[model samples]
Target: MSGAPERRTRGRTSPSRLRALDAYLLHCERPLLERQDGPWGEAAFLDVGFGEHPWTTLESARRFRALNPSLRVIGVEADPGRASAAASHEEERTHFRQGGFGWAREAGQPVRLIRAMNILRQYRAEEAGAAHEELGQALLPGGLLVEGSTDGPGGITVAYLLRRGAEGLAREALLFHTDFHQGFAPRLFRDWLPVDWRRRMVPGSALHAFFAAWTAAWAEARAQGADSPADSFHEGARRLSQAWPGVSAEPWLWENGYLRWQPPTEVPRPQGL
Candidate 1:
């Protein structure tokens, strides 16, 4: 964690705002959630910048505990008052801490997973990488950092699934999800991309090209009779996977409005970020 202070960001949040993300992790990141050997035995699941309330953090604690009963859960807030107020909900295995990205390291807590959803919207895009590094410093090897943004009600989300490795946090994959509450389109994710990528989708860039291809695939799917949003997404994703390397063909993902693109190498960082 850097010694520099973290700027305070908006704390708006609603109940169940991140439920879809929780379900996605429980289903797709089972190995990470279930592992309990070595450092994992004492590792905690950290929810960074948990907003004005700890509802999401509490919900995730219940959901993840089903897989690892002894798992410790910590909800961290940069705001001292919010963090202190959250303490009322703490139990034997849950805690509310007032700190920034360096909270875990400062407290000597080993982390298995970190969720920093919707916390970077106010920061400069160039600062996201450093933030990621600071947040990942306390993770045990193989731990995961899920950093991203979701819509107001959380029907849509896009996150970076970074994995801690021998080298450091590897930009492993990009996860896109939409429940179709407002209907679906490849463009729907542009506004919800992780902070670093939200403004990097210009022409000539990989991110732009990726979205262009997806939009084309979606149109083609619709032209071929994919009617509903879900159907269009599934068909378009299937086509995109065929043309794009590393697009996951996993049936469950398409069926559930999730798309995981894990390139053979690191997911490309849009230049100039």
Candidate 2:
């Protein structure tokens, strides 16, 4: 494990806890998932901290393989016992391993994607930068690293989509999604944001400004007769996109409870990061 500091986290996870995230990726990252040239031809999708069971990992494998049947999937758990127990679910195209942030680099695996959901919640906010760098070290150029948190039933999720490029891992965008299970409100995602962004949503911060704009848009939409949760969300997102520089205006995203905010510049990093 490279003597890296170990992570001690709860192994509480349920089946399909990350299905929304998988679907988002399948829709937006189709090219990355389906490409089979050069390094991508042998790259693997690494699911880190897949918890007590490999259900989410297995679920993603099925969804992603629909695009590329030859894809390889590996589930990584920090707990040795949990890792061993998950081995029973392995197949010719899937595997389980005991490791942490640096696993892919140490194992000499080329990676096309890395999903580290709900893994860094227990870590101090200041530690996220190093963790991100470590996790992206093995990604092939143009590959992606999705790290974030989702609500228990997977009704809400906020993730960082970092893409590896010639310059390194770029903080490409902040992806927000919700099923409106708790009704629609911009603040519903505050608690589910990635660890680095969770503490940065205070006054004078870019994230705070972003949320403020969203709140305003929501209120405006409500005033315009968008009454239901779904209606408010869809209309608010449409207004936010018009007011915001880089918010996506795609009808599919708004209608389906998703908002992808990719600023013209990279997602602003918290001071320490």
Candidate 3:
């Protein structure tokens, strides 16, 4: 699902993006929203790193407005084109801006919900932790950050519902396939790290994995040392899993996916430590 564009499209947008959004909404998001907020208290949401297409963000806004006109949504796209496209939608409760995860926090608000699709798949493996932490910091304590990638416009999409900070864990995730047009199904979770940032390596791409490592290391700094971010991360991750075991160690390891790290009671010593 990382290389969502790995698939193709009749138009500029990879068909995966379009299809994935629809499946997630029809099968998952709406019901989840109701359960999470009790009939629609999620009037505010953040799109952490939208690229060229904020189509999903705009569509989400439309649905939220329909569900609760008081709902207000913001799209934070690092790319101007995506922001512009989202802006064009200009619906009753949708808005777009040019920035990264810090956009809203910079403006002073911890979002209730965040969507950071397609961002992780592109990062270098090592940077995953720090990136997750940085992005996680912007969420309200109990808020959710859905992270993952789709194959293309309407192909197959898989994403995880990540919570904010190291203390956050994915409560649920979904997988969708357009070939048969099935709705989203909840994916099991694990306490293991959601991704292996340290293992990500690129041969010829301009993107690098060091960021993933840095982010991850920072996230877990406290767990790694008295002055280490890994140590803190370990503490956060453990607390998260304790709060929700489903996110601890996914029983679905044999499946195509599972949670990454197995958190410890105390800040875990880094693997190498």
- Give TM per candidate: 0.97, 0.97, 0.54
Off by over 4 Å in 3: 1-43, 165-273
**Candidate 3 lDDT tens digits, 1-273:** 221212121223442364444434434345434434542354367776656666666666656555445666888766666667668866666678877655665776646677776666655445554555556666766566666665544344445556544556443342222232332112111111234412322333211322244235434544455253223334433443445423343333212222233222322222321
Pairs in steric clash, model 2:
none
Clashes of each: 0, 0, 54
lDDT of 1 by residue, 1-273 (tens): 473367676699989989888989999888888888888888999999999999999999999999999989999999998999999999999999999998998899999999999988878788898898999999999999999999899899999999999999999999999999988899999888888888887899888888888899999999999989999999999999999888999999999999999989989997975
TM-score between candidate 2 and the true structure = 0.97
> Candidate 2 at residue 185, lDDT?
92
lDDT values for all models: 0.91, 0.91, 0.48
- Model 2, 28-143: lDDT tens per residue? 88999999988888899999999998999999999999999999999999999999999999999999999989999999999999999998887878888788889999999999
Local error of candidate 1 at residue 131 (angstroms): 0.3
Q: Which is superior by lDDT, 1 or 3?
A: 1
User: What shift in Å separates residue 155 of candidate 2 from its native position after superposition?
Assistant: 0.5
